[model samples]
Target: GGISRAGRDALGEATAKILASANTYENQTIFLTGSKAYTLKEITSFISKILGRDIPLRFVSLEEYINQYLNCLDEYWVRLWARTYLALKREELARVYPTLENLLGRKPKSLEQTIKEIFTDKQTGEKESKLTNKYWQASTFDNK
Candidate 1:
């Protein structure tokens, strides 16, 4: 399929942003996925031009992302549904907490680090009781 001019422009801009952000961070890994349409070479060319360095970037299709990251779920519909559900729950938590200070402990410097810790704890089968709906209210006192 032929790429639209507008699409190319958008991709170029996204590539530039990615490269700039990646260069700013030390030892950064960027993941890009959008079905099976995007081109790695085009993105790399733009990134290389912006960063002034030849850095290897990883590219994976949406199918590959779901297959590898979301193992237990086979159907795409199911995976998307579960993703939506989790997103809503996270939003609900954010609404109540409003800030990282409202969380059970001190906030990590990096959100990525916090997510990694959460995933590790889950993988190790650490016991964590799910938050109750009643606790969704914003409280004046830190009730941990």
Candidate 2:
């Protein structure tokens, strides 16, 4: 999976609810999660459908990942990410929790909605947004 994956908007709302009821939710630990956990393959497939462009993917081993990123990222970050990916592969953060929806009293923004927010203007439905362009530019893909 790409991440334990909760939309930022949904997470923010959940945080607000917890803060608002500080007395009730005091000293509590909640694992906020998306409606579902999406794998990287699924996310890229959705992105390709929306953007009408192929986004290539290449899998790498833990050592490969660390070496590939070490130049651009510090050793600390590279090692941290390596560990995180290992945990992800083990499905440590794969569980989806309803605590967010329960607190919000409505369905939280989904991963697809978050993708739309990043790539398109919701109100106008115009061309791809600047953020989308930046995303493409910043992204490093293995086309192999």
Candidate 3:
């Protein structure tokens, strides 16, 4: 349920081209996005791989996630967002858009590759941040 490699490449190329020819599309609103879409579960799996750890996942209704986890007034927006996300059909998200591919004359990268690129540093080959490591270490799951 994620973008293909061709889609990623197409998106990058399209961005570069748009920037180069800014004068042509200066006032126009362009809807540029990944040709393919991925579900939250797929995205989390990619993140787990990038972090080199197993990330436990559980599916729950919007009411469950909100009632069990969200407790503060400040977190109301998160509950709203989750409700909105859960409302969409999986089929709707799985549909691919060819606009990006047509514009760039190529396909985009796979979801896995894109996640790796985003999480790994280009020069050092290390993860972009140690936050995941810290969180895992500090979490009480192991103790349980």
Best-performing candidate as measured by lDDT:
2
TM-scores of all predicted structures: 0.21, 0.80, 0.59
- Candidate 2's error at 137, in angstroms? 10
Q: In model 3, which runs have C-alpha deviations exceeding 4 angstroms?
A: 1-33, 67-73, 128-132, 136-144
Residues 1-144, model 2: lDDT tens digits: 445487787889889989888999878888898778877777777777778877766676667767887889999987875676666666776788889889888888778778877777778785476454644422223312
Stretches > 4 Å off in candidate 1: 5-39, 57-63, 68-144
Pairs that clash in candidate 1: none
Q: Model 1 over residues 2-113: C-alpha lDDT tens digits?
A: 1111223334555565666665645854332221222334444443443344535543343444464455765766557445324433332122221222221332233323
TM-score winner between candidates 2 and 3: 2
The all-Cα superposition gives candidate 3 an RMSD in Å to the true structure of 6.8
- Candidate 1: what lDDT? 0.35
Please report the TM-score between candidate 3 and the true structure.
0.59
Best by TM-score: 2
Clashes of 1: 0
Kindly give the stretch of ten consecutive residues in candidate 3 with the minimal lDDT sum: 135-144
